[model samples]
Target: MVNLWTSSEHALSYLAIADAIPHRTEGEGVLLNQVPKTVRRILDLGTGNGRLLSLLKIDRPQAECIGLDFSPTMLAAAQEQFMGDDSVHVQVHDLDQPLPDLGQFDAVVSSFAIHHLAHERKRSLYAEIFACLAPGGVFCNLEHVASPTERLHQQFREAMGIGDRPDDPSNKLLDVETQLQWLRAIGFEDVDCYWKWLELALLIGRKPTV
Candidate 1:
């Protein structure tokens, strides 16, 4: 399966409409609430244009942040957005592979990313994220998850104003329950779906201190 995100055209197309994804801000709001103001450092995966990272920085200005994206277009845009900020770093990384040694973080975040990975890769990434977190750290993923039925899936697409158009082949959405289970299995304490609006949901978990 081709990951459209690597193509500049595909990446640009999505960014053009990224903010208008309807009810997206609500999910982001919930994600922000979970990341405490005390975080010292954070990592963002597939951080398209560094949108989510920028928001987090506003709440925790002292926290150093790193953002990763495979798409050159996205990486460039993220770098440009954070160019003047001494605390932000943007790097090129393919989420399908293992995460690099960016050092442990008090928080790891992602927005509308990760669903593009194979289900197995998603699980492995979750394990890797757990490994990369400091004790009692947080992971917040505001993602596009699978619907319980084809009808509901179609409804969500329609709600997004993409009625009947072919679905993005890059998306490999997993169900919320399954993802929450994976988090718990990976030893993420207090794992749960913190917020949801149709297919868009926030999955959050904490690394246990003990």
Candidate 2:
């Protein structure tokens, strides 16, 4: 069965510590800079509490935004965050399944969410994201990628304040190089790992206009 993040405690814990994750704001800033100001519509996958989408909306106040996540508790929190705000739409959808018919978007973004998917599913989901984006659109994934070695992995765990604990079974970490290659092969232009610190990295790619 899919390890959906349904438990309120787990969801809340993520939110509580989400901001304290080191180098996160820097990565988020890079992602924000990459998005074109002309973008009129945006989609966010695995939008826990709609954080990334909410940030995007702050700058692009007139842009239409849609946030998708699978956790019921997360959905509730996101809904509450966007309450009385019409510019953003929040929905619950498992990333383990195919994306819905939400139409096209000028940009798609995710933060520390896609790594939970299986390797094959991650590639397939990138393809789906490509198909859903308008030409010239961009995809920004602030992901938790795998470290180079067991030692590096341990170091990463230390950085995250996790030690002597097993890696989250829910994590299916992929390396930055492989994911960037997949992005390029899937027709994403200018694909690269924009920023990284330990296991946390900002992977960016743009849909070709041609």
Candidate 3:
């Protein structure tokens, strides 16, 4: 099935209500706190309008960041937001496919993206992300993950004001434990779910310096 994110309408619709997501800022804040200020180059995958990258820039202002997304609407928005700021590079990239040669980064991040891919691709992407990071580099993914049980999943949806509505078929949610295991298997150190609120979670891992 084609991902809805590729559609301009679908992309725009999400952006329209993006700010209303409850506790999102809190999670973003925790994610930011984990990233070191000394980072020089950062890579943001599936970057929607450069929102998270914009937050990261406040602390790591000297860091050159690449905000990548395949959707034209998202890319346009990100481009418009980061325009005239040479420190931030907005580029096109599809998460469903192998990442292009974008060079190594001191930190890599993604927010509310990646769940659209198949389960297997998710693990492979973690491996690819590990390869793209410099030694001691951090990978922080603020994600929409699967709940332990279907009942809990329903409860989470209700809490998010998604009561009784047909779920987004685009989401291929995976459990947090499995994703953390994948990170460890991929040779990342300090793999863990650093913060979580029901279905929303922040999974972080670091590339070993040695």
* Each model's lDDT: 0.94, 0.91, 0.93
* Candidate 1 residue-wise lDDT at 117: 94
Question: 2 or 3, which is superior by lDDT?
Answer: 3
Please give the distance, in angstroms, between residue 66's alpha carbon in candidate 1 and its true position after superposition.
0.4
Segments in model 1 whose C-alpha atoms lie over 4 Å from true places = none
Candidate 1 C-alpha lDDT tens digits along 133-177: 999999999999999999999899899999769989999988999
Tens-digit lDDT track of model 3 for 1-210 = 658888999999899889998889989999999999999999999999999999999989999999889999999999999889999999888888899888999999999999989998998999999999999999999999999999999999898888878888889999999999999999999989989999999999999999
Best-to-worst ranking by TM-score: 1, 3, 2
Q: Which ten residues in a row have the lowest lDDT in candidate 2?
A: 1-10
Estimate the lDDT of model 2. 0.91
**Model 3 weakest 10-residue run by lDDT:** 1-10
Residue 177 in candidate 3, Cα distance off native in Å: 0.2
Q: lDDT for model 3, on a 0 to 1 scale?
A: 0.93
Q: Give the TM-score of candidate 2.
A: 0.97
Q: Among these predicted structures, which one has the highest lDDT?
A: 1
